[model samples]
Target: MQRRDIAEMLLLAALWGASFLFMRVGATDFGPAALVFLRVAGASLLLLPLLAWRGEVGALRAQWRPIALVGVVNTALPFALYMVALLVLSAGLASIFNATAPLWGALIAWAWLGDRPTPLRGLGLALGFAGVLWLGIDNASLRAGSAGVSPALGIAACIAATACYGWTANYTKQRLTGVPPMAVAAGSQAFAALATLPAALWWWPATLPGPTAWAGAAALALACTGLAYLLYFRLIARVGPAKTIAVTFLIPAFAVLWGAMFLGERLTPTMLGGCAVILLGTALATGLLRTRRSRPAGSPAP
Candidate 1:
């Protein structure tokens, strides 16, 4: 990969990693459903003009079923799950757990697409689970004894959210391959906003949040959702889905840094070690560490 592409991937990772921090901040004032609604609503408004400019509005209108399904699974449901997990889990831990999306993607691909899992990939999956287990076992703050929910439950929620993300990743690749990324992003956000509107209304706060909370929500929508999706689509176009999806590996690092900077959270050795293992597993699942075949001894090996 070129240096420029690598830089873009890193930037993408940073933006996504920052999302955990944003969600943690915003969740203090908004319920999970309300936060997700505002996020999708804000992103939809920001991207609507772009969709109209590209004359892709009709495509969304025509493909409402799959578009809405993708929106619900990819944006609404997983975002809400992450927000709920953030309510109990540290930003760094949540991001690290979410990084398991690629592992689940590999499993989903094997089951749904009939893609055989290599031995290395299987070992990578086991190592990834071990990393998650280590995080759960070592993180006292995630336990009920530490004034939080059970550590196991928090970990489960994070893994479930990532599994949803994994499913949607392959789903989009197979079903929505030819569609414009902007359209997919915009339409999905719009649909998610619509789906979450009633829940947001039902759980609406008694009073409005201060400007800080409102601004954070807006930034989550605009920067994290709208702009992030644009960058993600660009990366997907430049490098195929597997390579673009590797950004999950960097999210934990960025998440930990952002939490330390903004939330005054402490970084621990366990967190660092877990993040490393998760990234290594992601590399294996994405085939980043796999060696390409070459002719051996002047004869074809295959």
Candidate 2:
């Protein structure tokens, strides 16, 4: 990767890492459904114009079906779930859950596409789930019902969101290959906005949230979803998915940093240990480490 590309990758990680912070701040006031709606709605407003500028708006019509599916699975649903999770979990903890996406994606690919995971990748998946369970149980007591959403529900929401992310990554690769990344980004956001608009209206707060929450939502929309996709697609073009996706490993660190400094969230021992295990597993799952492969797979991952 070029120097500039590396910088962009780092920036992308920072932007995405901060998303948990935004969600943590905003989800309480905005509610999960409304906050996710605003996120995708706001991002669509920003990304679609850039898509138009790139003359890729036309691609949306051709790819509308898969794009819409991607929007629902990848953006709308997961965003809502994670925002719900953020309502209870610390930004740093939620961010650690975010790192599990690749692990779930790999398993989904294995099951859905008949893409066999080698022993190393399987071990990674095992490790990732182990960490997630440990972290979840340690961070929050699993009980039948609590006054508000239980910490355990929050944990389940986060894991399920990552599972949705995983499934959709495979769905997109199978259904929308060769579509311009910008079009995918913009179109998905637009469709997500449309999909979730009704839920957002129904769930909208009777009383408006404070300025900080509003600002957090705006930053989550424009900077994290909007600008971050632009950087993400550019790096994918320059460095390939293997290198660009490596940013996943770095995001939790920045989330931990930002949460500690800004949100006054502390890193507990379980959080640290679980995060380390999850990232190590993600590295293996994402092919950051050398893993055994079969010949039918065509070639080993980079």
lDDT of 2 at 277: 94
Error of 1 at 254 (Å): 0.9
Across residues 219-273, which tens digit of lDDT does each residue of candidate 1 receive? Answer: 8999988988888888878877767777877788899999999999888899889
The list of candidate 2 runs beyond 4 A from truth reads 143-147, 291-302
CA deviation > 4 Å runs, candidate 1? 1-3, 140-149, 292-302
Q: How does each model score on TM-score? A: 0.91, 0.93
Taking all chains together, the TM-score of candidate 2 against the true structure is 0.93
The 10 consecutive residues of candidate 1 with the worst lDDT sum are 293-302
Q: Per-residue lDDT tens digits of candidate 2, residues 184-292?
A: 9999999999999999999999999888788889999999999999999988888889788889988999899999999899999989999999988887766687644
Winner by TM-score: 2
Q: Could you tell me which residue pairs clash in candidate 1?
A: none
Q: Rate the local accuracy (lDDT) of all candidates.
A: 0.83, 0.89
